[model samples]
Target chain A: MQSGEDLNQDFRPETEAGGLTIRLDVFQGPLDLLLHLIKREEVDIWNIPIARITEQYLEYLEIMKELNINVAAEWLVMASTLIFIKSRMLLPREPAPENAEETEDDPRTELVYQLLEHQKFKNAAEMLFTREEVENAVWNRPPDEVLEDGGDVIAVTLFDLLRAFQEVVRRFESQRVMEVAQEEVTIEQKIEDIRKCFLVHDQLQFSSFFTAASSKRYIIVTFLALLELVRLREIWLFQQQVFEEIQVSRIKESA
Target chain B: MQAVMEAIIYVAEEPVKAEQFQEVFPEESPEAIRRALAELLESFNARPGGMWIREVAGGYRMTTRPEHHEQIRAYLKTRPGAKLSMAALETLAVIAYKQPVTLAEILAIRGKKSSSSLQTLLERKLVCILGRKEVVGRPILYGTSREFLIHFGLNSLADLPTLEEFAQMAGDQL
Candidate 1:
């Protein structure tokens, strides 16, 4: 049933113009926007009225342009795809042979499939959103409040540790002696020194390694040794919580 | 045995696995520990209390019941990270449903460049690189991480509602 003419009549530009005042960011992508358009139009997903939809989709892009929203490339690509499909569907199909075995190919087939697939995940995303909403309400004991300043559950990355190290270095530089002195600190020697320290204590603050250093070279060497130990899995470096001191724990054999 | 198991689970910093319980009680068989865990789970569920013993990421953890969420929300000063963006959620849904998927496959389904959303998911530790696909370009394959299951309070990936179920739910909503 080709309701193309009826849908074309139904596509009122003025009414639709006001309808699209909502933000462009509401759509996750082109498919999401198309699905929204299809749902709003109450059209069959399998047999989308492409001419009407392409017009509406372009209108949306135009609105986004007017609103000064950066329309992603994917939206433009889908626009062309809709135009191509609309043109293909408008063209008359060649007559098939009496004994033709192959099914008729519709240009919209690929798009319909993509839309259906995206819709499935969209629905899945909604389901996940609901679950997340419910789960967010249920608090785990000890709360696992990662955003807390001293919460030990939050993980710290190599970048955070490096930033902390930079701060330590900056402080040392600010309070350093004016005299330049060469230091004899090797990475291997520093690594051995760290290993010996771990043998006595289960854990040590990261800054503890640099406290005895007399020169910047010694601190740099110690940092390198720490990295080497980490690479070797001989020691573990981690913050107990966000914005807290990083602790270097010995990697016991059992762990 | 149930009380002992509950205490161990309560004291755990993270979800305590059945294997961990078995490791803790070396003399007990795996089946015995599993039975005790099942019993403990049932006992907690049977009571109309504030606490729920949930199985998340294949491990047990204690969490306040959702019914008391509004009260808890009012009492607590800080909250968990902000909810994920729609784009990030959609990308995560694709990766969760289709594990070992490449960026190309995800782009095909989403009909969008998912790199940013993928980056967000990776940063949140919800999605992880499974390894590279053995294709021409060897694009990185992605899958949901253990944190993903925990975030949704799921026992495992299998606990996620089926796509068919989602379709039905969507139908009802519409």
Candidate 2:
């Protein structure tokens, strides 16, 4: 409470005297800084006095610069905007519109509007932070509680399967480039190849499809063909466990 | 009936709405079902176990207590817990409030590029694509998902507290 002029004084970047270091982490963006200013000054958002707020905004930037905090460009753009509005406010006012009151219309109206709009979202953000903080403690129960139903099937999404494919792809992939004209392996042909491989064994490893593939094109084509089979539910792709070799199994349609 | 209710809520995958239980017991009233729920809540609250049933996203389900998070985290080392980055959480907050919003709209509010964060949220099933926004590019509309509600322990969209509430609290402390 020492030398505290406002309630938001704690949130404002506290400069360390005789030492220089400020946490820029607190500033979310340009609007966040403006919100801090408005709160600290207790200014009426609808009728902001541009000169004072702009001065304070620029001073914070100065301190940030002196303390060697890397400020983002958006913050500087806002600074320019505030300065422009303050300069306009200092100039003589134009005559009011026919239906408008002189005091009601000001050059600061647009800037104030933007600030108010940003403030609403900022408040929502704060609420979300609290929810995250509280929910971080509450863990979802085990599979006994079935909110989302249907066969578990490993709960693998297309992206997750793709990532798993990448891991296996890295192992057997050769670095040979294939010209389009030299190797025009269609996805259908690759699928046929995979089917032929599965005929020899009930299951095949992820990298087995790329076996003897001299070019990246063949490997990519084989991967795409696998994805097509997966999409059709003709085959299922999964690892025995996490980080294990991915195995492809044929769906039991008779069951 | 309450014991049956407790088992059903604990075993159910999603939140067990009272209407669902009402359908099972055609003659029972919703008020009676609600009373059963209140009794269950009281009984659970009285216990000191690491698990408790909570009404989240419109139904009741058991969730692990926060105090046991560290212990459970250690126990469940094989699996990854649902954790979000600051940027993603901020973006989610905006979408949770102003849903059916576009990437451009989110970027405008966050004052930063949010494509990566949006992708992460989509992958986590926390945010979902609600369809095109009917704007210039027909950009995909984004909204918070049922998974989002469950993850955040929200009973419904109405459960979200206004942001100014926290700011007001800060003011009071000052």
Candidate 3:
């Protein structure tokens, strides 16, 4: 429960007794993970808070290491790149050229450009995902899908996948911040709150618990806690209609 | 002749080419069938209806009006066909606009390795190998499948909006 920087500092390098196990959740890869982190931080992608972002990035790596998640080389290289940029940023700026019009280039500029360029494609990806979601609802003929797989496959669009992934990432971010701040309300506390609500009502609206959030961090953590409960199969997310409010329902076994 | 052509187009599960209409009814000339198709399209446009015939992938098919999307969606819950992930979609988009492109071409645009995404798209039958790129590595060239046209509800590759159009749409949204 250390700060991101502290987590990196405290963790031993050789404690990787656990074998690498990365669940290939198709929606979340290296860039997607970085984008999620950047979005949760709510900073300009063009002007990243490199030092803090790098700390958080490495902290994620630390957790992944502990869990033995297979860290891709791209992620490691990006980490190195961030560190390289940080180092370059630390160095004193070079004096301007004789032309007097040119300015010394910031080391972060290249990475920032890459992120922005990546963002454009990501935006385009989102557009196509949305289009698929839209056009998918109406079909001239039924698509040739092997639907008899029996409840294993979730036909979630990238949009839903990304949204769900985003929520989890945001929740993870909040949880880290809470750990740093030493908050009174833990995810376990939120789980308890959810259980109490389920006792009172058959179903709970996701938004009803918080009409207006005083702290974005706590709300996100609560949502994350809710997801953890869902992961444990204690509850499930459902909606009566597309674009309707999501509701929480307790599993029959849990009752 | 127009009625016969409508019947033929209606019966087709996939898009029906004008040549297909001629081939099916060899007694009718391709020119006559083309005229019938034009007239049928004009009639559909003139009338207010849920269905409209549109050309896609070098063939014509009837599709529901976008305005009735919500109503149709309500009536047919869980019919929202197959989905492509953002990674796959981005890979597909790159291939879509810059078709007959190699895997490298797609990777260059997206700035990520698209091996898995491309495989997923191929499995979904949304994209297919057009041919070999004829370059040194000769990486397989990819293009949108006919199924992709049906899936995206596009009349043709030409139906895809230009990047500027997308920018304008984004501008409007903002």
Candidates 1 onward: DockQ, in order: 0.55, 0.30, 0.16
TM-score of chain B of each: 0.92, 0.85, 0.82
Of the candidates shown, which would achieve the greatest DockQ relative to the real structure?
Answer: 1
Instruction: Name the runs in model 1 displaced over 4 angstroms.
Output: A1-23, A97-103, A143-255, B167-174
What TM-score, computed on C-alpha atoms, does each candidate reach? Answer: 0.80, 0.66, 0.59
Question: Between prediction 1 and prediction 3, which has the larger DockQ?
Answer: 1
- lDDT (CA) per prediction: 0.80, 0.73, 0.67
How are the candidates ranked when ordered by DockQ, highest leading? Answer: 1, 2, 3
Kindly list the per-residue Cα lDDT of model 2 for residues A2-50, writing each as its tens digit.
2235434433554678665555555567766676777677777766778
Minimal lDDT window, size 10, model 2 chain B: B165-174
Highest TM-score model number: 1
Return the candidate ranking by TM-score, descending: 1, 2, 3
Residue pairs that clash (backbone atoms under 3 angstroms), model 1: A152-A240
Off by over 4 Å in 3: A1-27, A98-104, A141-255, B22-35, B45-50, B64-79, B108-111, B164-174
Worst 10 residues of 1 chain A by lDDT: A1-10
User: lDDT, candidate 1, residue A7?
Assistant: 26
